[model samples]
Target: MRKLTWGVWLGTSMLLAACGGSGGSQDSGLEPPPQDPRFVADNAQWREERRERLLQPDGWASLVGLHRLELNAHYVGSGATNGIRLAKGPEKLGLLQQSGGRVWLVPERGVALTLDGEPVKARFELKPDTDQSPSIVGFDEGNGQLSLLQRSGGKALRVKHADAETRTQFGTLEYWPADAGWRIDASFVPHATPRTLEIMDITSQLQALPNPGVVEFERDGARYRLEALEGEEGGLFLVFADRTSGHESYGPGRYLYTDAPDRSGAVVVDFNRAYNPPCAFTDYATCPLPPHENRMDLAVTAGEKRYRRPTP
Candidate 1:
């Protein structure tokens, strides 16, 4: 059977000072050569962009609920009596029906709602994320969104609201200092034939993702290899865990992305860019776990650390 290529759907700074007074034992004036300015600036920019993406109205942090759509129909809303209870929304938002391998939404009369940004008076089919253009049901005056998501286990509804406590109370994202040394040059080793890697997600759903090759690099005189997944845009997607996992980093693992190998099969694997998955921020996400092959015994002290949710 042909293996499936799952698409990866997702989305940092400081300053320093110099010394003066070249007398009294002649201060070296070389304050540890302040990490490559370019590298530091780039890393800072990346971190800031990452934070902005997460704080967006529809970002992972805004996710408030993930309800499985197993039944034929379900009334969804914030009301306690609704079949699918939402954390935030109008009392009678809409009714969803599943048929013909598709989910349809019927807006509740007298309730304001929009289907794909347009007013809807009749039931309409909801496009799942599998489609090129998925349908979005907007509610709460556009602050809330409802979308269909299909995962390894089954189909479900992913609800996001700008006012979600998770998003409103999001905490800080810590990281180890950005060091260029973490960016290592690696060589790609292609498989004789394509292979499938069994990736188990946070939901414990095992999926056979396309595993096309491996990247090998040497760190501390030891050769380290990571199996590479064929990303949606032809880049290399690496989900990995290291010695820092559960101690200094996210327990499950972190994600990293790299451009395609060059003509000489050379790729740059920058551990400094490794980041935590969405599951680290919210429980609604079904993030894939790192395969055993990608687990490194080496401690990767770079990239993001385990998220610390702020206290009320």
Candidate 2:
């Protein structure tokens, strides 16, 4: 009887212990959030966007021309020779026109202009700006003159190639799997005073931009916030750095956006979509840096991985 009682007690104790362990595991912070269905569809869309942008319009494939006139420039269009040669005077003003079905730049006579391997001599007709202007402009439409006006009052299209050191040498970017665990349905955390955010440049210069409210969420029982900035696209632009940066991800930081989300304060921050800044590929862009407030103390392991490339 004594032996049987001892065995029963031992069995009961083990059963109770197992139940307690199971409860603790259910609430462990080690596991990621549940997967959301919408992210699967979003992933497909991003892949297509990447192909159209990075693959087809290889930056190295285009010719960059910087036309700076001392007073006026003589040139050729596509169809005439000893063409509309005019001096650097008032006569140069009305030579070219963009009207009807086409635009024309009647070049002065005896001038030569070869375009994309075609021996284009001076002519009375004009041709199109052959390159697709893919880079989003810093100015508004009809304001393309901004690009025409070069940096530091000079005129030049700083050249970058498709086979650029960054592009050519890039290995596959690392990413946290598209598991729904990272997407936390979040809500707006409004601020009374609009905050000013600064993005640090390569030269360690800071540029200030305004930010409205922020989006907030709770992770590991701690509340975190990301302030919002105005962007051309209708979404939030978040520049943030964390402990994982430089080690598991881009050294400077990773970026995220506030796309449309559901009710759970759950926003899909697809790490796979994280990519290099324009600075990575070329020197001409003015990309915004992460704000100081966005810097997180913890490691954000989910999302796009660091870009691996050969030394430039």
* Alpha-carbon lDDT, every model: 0.82, 0.45
Candidate 2 lDDT, tens digit per residue, 1-312?
A: 011122233223223332322111112256555556687678756755653464333342111223332233333222333133221112222234344534344434443333333334443333333325312211111111112222223222222233334444444544565665565666764468877666665434566666756777666777777776764454566776655555555555666766754444445444455555544333344445555566666567666655544454
Model 2 stretches astray by more than 4 angstroms: 1-41, 56-157, 162-165, 168-170, 193-195, 260-273, 281-285
- In model 2, the number of clashes is 16
- In the predicted model 1, the residue pairs found to clash are 12-44, 12-47, 12-48
lDDT string for model 1 (1-312, tens) is 112232121100000000111112212344333688989999999999999999999999999999998799999999999999999999988889998788898999988888889987788999999899999999989999999998778999999999999999999999888888889999988889989899999788998989989999998888888899987566799998766666667777899999989878899998888999998888899899888677776778788876778878
RMSD to the native, candidate 1? 9.8
Q: Report the error of model 1 at residue 125, Å.
A: 0.6
Prediction 1 global C-alpha lDDT: 0.82
